[model samples]
Structures are given as structure tokens and as C-alpha cells.
Target: MIKWIAAFLGYFLFRFPGAVLGFIVGSFLDNFGGSGNRTRTVFENVTRQSVSPADFELNLLSLCSIIIKADGQVNQRELDYVRQYFLSTYGKEKANAIFRTFNQVIKKREISAERICSFMVQRTRYEVRLQLLHFLFGIAQSDGQVSKAEAQKLKEIARYLRVGQHDFESIMAMFIKSADTAYKILEIEKTATDDEVKKAYRTMAKKYHPDRVVTENEAIRKGAEEKFKEVQKAYETIQKERGLS
Candidate 1:
């Protein structure tokens, strides 16, 4: 059955890049079997829409490599975080393949951050773009702190993505724990009344909710879930500090 599906995909997607992508995707589907069915839905949607799965995956890998190398050297911790992410999202075989590809891209350093970001901005939905930014933050913090170089690179990526400063700051607050970070995460001013803070929290909670991401991709939804949790934690921190219930 899987062979038939792969053959069918290969036949239909016989074009150069699509043929190659179809073969890879078909193999992934074969490995996933029942558990991977959801990815097929996402694949179908991508085929019908703007970006192909291969392009999307490659763009992610390219941008991730840029983040990993932003601070002079790539740490094992950052590599491990990326490996774990791909493993949990795409299974072991695909994860290993992606890691290898990522290494090659990094070694070549041929893909520009601007080119990748521009492509993503044109093809990816806003929510997915935000999720990507969130993931970059995770990569930067893999070594326990986001360095100045990494933060600047992230800001550049966010600017290219047209993500609002508030939104970028909100995501940043999640990884950086500072006295003002909680307020930034909630997008509320410190001078706001307790009621105002509560309102901001609710607004941010609703905005960053996992369900609001509107994608069939479970991995993307899971990333949004992390953002959702960050919002909740930020709100709680604010309440505790301000002596509000």
C-alpha cells in the first residue's frame, strides 16, 4: 500500500523538485503509517496552496542554521535542541536526514537569511511565521541564554517577517526572565491598573491560543501551545508580583 502511494506520488509529481520531494514524503508517510496520516493532510494542503512541504521544511532548516551560527560558534546544546525538535516532529529517520541537510547548509552558508525570510514572509501564513520566530528563540536559548548576536539576528528576522515589535517582544519575554519581561509578554504597561493588566492577559491568551494557529500541522499547533503556556505564565507572574488574584 505504501509502495503504491509512493509510486502514485512519484508519477504525479514527476517534475524535478516535486519528484524528489514526493519520494521523500512518500517514504515519510510509509514510516508514519497510521500516526503519520495527519501529515498527509498538511501535505495535500501545501500542494494545493503556496509552499510545498519540501520548501517549507527547507526554509525552516535554512533559517534555523542561521540562528545556530549567529553567535560565532554553534554549540552542541543548540544542535541537540534542533535534533530533538526534528526527531519529535518528523520521526528518527527524517530527523537524521534533516540534521544532515542542516549541517550541509550551515557548512555551505550559501542561503542568505534575507532570502529565506523573504520567501517565508511571502508564502507562510502570519501565525506560522510567528511560530517560526518562537522556535528560533528556543534555539537561541538552548545554551541557557540568548546572546547579543543571537538577539540581533532574531530581531532582523522578525523585522523581515513584518512581525510587530510588540509581538516580537512578547515572544522574547518568554525566554528572557526579567522584572519587565512579564509585562512585555502580556503587552501591558507597568503603570496599568490591576484590571487593565487582567484585560491584557486575557487578550494575549486569546491571541496566542494554540487553536488560533489555524493549521493542520500538529507540530505547528504544538509550538503555539508553548506560546500559549508562555502567556499564561507571564500573566501569573504579573499577578504574583502585583498582589493581584
Candidate 2:
């Protein structure tokens, strides 16, 4: 039994660096943040303390790898984009942890597309799923335009995530609609006064307030939540620019 467990552990340790590393980083961050109890329930009810690092790495790589492949190439800019994003969102320590795991996962030669697809299909959170989609969209736009292959891959990923066609369209629309260079969110004109911003916020807040939108369709709820976040971020950006808040 000892030998058997040891062999199993070795196999996984060799196979799945990302999953194990993700679990470790996740667990460590959970502990560090001291809010594991209040975090997404997916981690809360997990039965096993020892998660396969490779599996976790594969999952993340699956998403990222697909995005890279979407453009039919993986350029330095895209790689830097992922690195910087992880650093900004998860901090250097956690990002390093994930990078270590991904490094191992990729070392396994000839990673199959089927396996990669399955990995993405299994892992990732519902809410985070949206964020991942957003990230993919961002990646697609890294070169100032998305390629046909990239577009199709994003759509395939969306389908795998069960994100409806309409939802996918809307998500893309949000990004595409902001064709301007202004940092302001909501895309309101630069000349807009304080009162105009206030009215826009009030209008959006009423429509997207979580409580108010709870009764709407799931797609609507999700869109509203994302939109609301955009609105809040935009409002904050404007305030900072005006030195009001």
C-alpha cells in the first residue's frame, strides 16, 4: 500500500505540475487571505487536500494555449500579456506558482488537443468563466485585431463553457463598442459634465443593481453584473481624473 500510494503520487507529480501548483497557490492564498470560508464554495467543499498540480496547470494552459493558437501563433507580446495579467491580478508570488506549474505541464511533450479541451471543460469557475472569456477576448485583441482562427477558437471556447451565442456577441460588443482611446468607461463623451455622469450612473445602477437584476434571466444577470462592474470602474476612473474621489 505504501509503495502503491507513492507510485501514484509520483506519477501525478510528474504529470500535473500546474494543477498541483494551482492547488497549492490557491490553498496558500486562501490561507493568507484568511477568507477561505467566504470564498467560492467550490474550494470550500473540496474533499481532497492533495490536488493534482498537473491537472490544474493543464486546465489553465488549456485556456491560454487555445488563445495563443487562435492567432495561429504565440508571440512574445501575448506571452508578456499573460505574465503581466497574472502578476497584476494574483500577485507575483501566486503568478510564479502558476508559471512553475505551467512550465512543467508544457514540458510534457506532444500535449494532445483533446486532453487540453477536456481540461478546460472540467476546470474553471462559473463567475471566473466569464473573466476567462474576457481575458481570451483581450488576448485576441492584443495585436489590435483578432485573426479568423482566433475568432473561431474563442467561439469554440465560449460554446464549451456553455456561454450562449447571444451572450458571446454581447461580451464582444462591450469591447468593440469602446473604439475610442479615452480611459473613461461607459464611453461617454469627454465634454460630459458632473450631472451628466451622475444621471448615466443612476440609470445604469438601476438597471444593473444586483438585487434588481436577480429576477432576470441568467444571461441578463451575468451581463448586467459585468456591465455594472464596468460602470463602477468607469465612474471611479472619471472621479480620479476629476480629482473628486
Which candidate number would show the highest lDDT if scored against the true structure? 1
lDDT of 1 by residue, 105-139 (tens): 67764556776777766655676577668768878
lDDT of each: 0.69, 0.54
- Score candidate 1 by TM-score against the native: 0.69
Expressed as tens digits, the lDDT of each residue in 1-245 for candidate 2 is 22233223322432222222223335444444423332222122223443343344345565676677655566667667666655543558866876776555444444444444444445544444555576677767766776778778778878777676655664665455543312344445667887777776677567557677553233334445656786677677677777764
What C-alpha root-mean-square deviation, in Å, does candidate 2 show against the real structure?
12.3
Task: Give the distance in Å from residue 87's predicted Cα in candidate 2 to where it truly belongs.
Answer: 2.9
Using alpha carbons, what is the TM-score of model 2?
0.51
Per-prediction tally of clashes: 0, 11
Off by over 4 Å in 2: 1-54, 89-97, 100-125, 177-208, 213-226, 229-245
